[model samples]
Target: MEITILVFGQIKEITGIAAWQISGIKSTEELAAKLVMQFPELALMKYAMAVNKILIQTDTELNENDTVALLPPFSGG
Candidate 1:
């Protein structure tokens, strides 16, 4: 029931930390809601989510100790 969250790029700047731990979150959808509640600025930004290093296109189930990453839009040359 515990999840580890990793924030990167602009997402990290919003949260002000690179990593943190959360509990009682059942799915990626719920996680998103919780994050927005904790960091309202996130609701205004666009980002992608990955569970355990795999990018997710839809709501995904989460497990104990699972690592969830919040990745902001980025460009590379």
Candidate 2:
């Protein structure tokens, strides 16, 4: 399946891109696990996943063409 991944803050810096496509993502947990494995540094940061703007848990099943945003914690007032 294909999904759009939106990186934020340090994630963008680490990946060097704000948004991109990901394939072979069977589930949301797999996605998050692969991300952490690919970008080990991300494991140190707090993040969340949203499917088409709706927040969901990592165990949530992913759908094809879903827009999943990787949102790191924000600290701006």
Candidate 3:
């Protein structure tokens, strides 16, 4: 399965990419593990995971071509 990960805020700076693709991810948790392994910087940051624009708290089932967004906490101006 190919998943598209969207990085935001400091994550974007850390990963140095707005979006990228990864394979063999069936759940959100698995993706998270892979991310931390690939980018050790992520474990030190705070963010939320969302699939197809919906915020997910637990390990959500993923499918091919799913777009997962990593969103950092937002602040109002």
Candidate 4:
């Protein structure tokens, strides 16, 4: 199962990439854990996740070719 990861705002800075692909991750929970393991800095930041452009408030199942986006908190006037 391959998942596409898209990072936005500060999250992108943390990961140092705007987008990338990962495999063998079964769910959103697993993906979060794996990302934190790979990028320890992410563990300290607050962010929202979207699966296929839908914001998720809880762990959600992921499928092959799904696009997961990491969005950091934003502020604007």
Query: Model 2, range 19-66, lDDT digits (tens) per residue?
Result: 999898978889888988988888887877788899886488888999
What's the residue-level lDDT of 46 in candidate 2? 82
Model 4, 1-77: lDDT tens per residue? 89999999999888889999999998999999999999999999899899999999999999999999999988876
- All models: lDDT? 0.94, 0.85, 0.93, 0.94
Ranking by TM-score: 4, 1, 3, 2
Regions more than 4 Å wrong, model 2 = none
Please give the lDDT score at residue 50 for candidate 4. 97
Model 2 RMSD to the real structure?
1.3
Candidate 4 deviant stretches above 4 angstroms: none
Which TM-score value belongs to model 1? 0.94
The local distance difference test score of model 2 is 0.85
Writing each residue's lDDT as its tens digit, candidate 3 over 1-77 gives 79899999889989999998988999999889899998999999889899999999989999999999999987868
Better of 2 and 4 by lDDT: 4
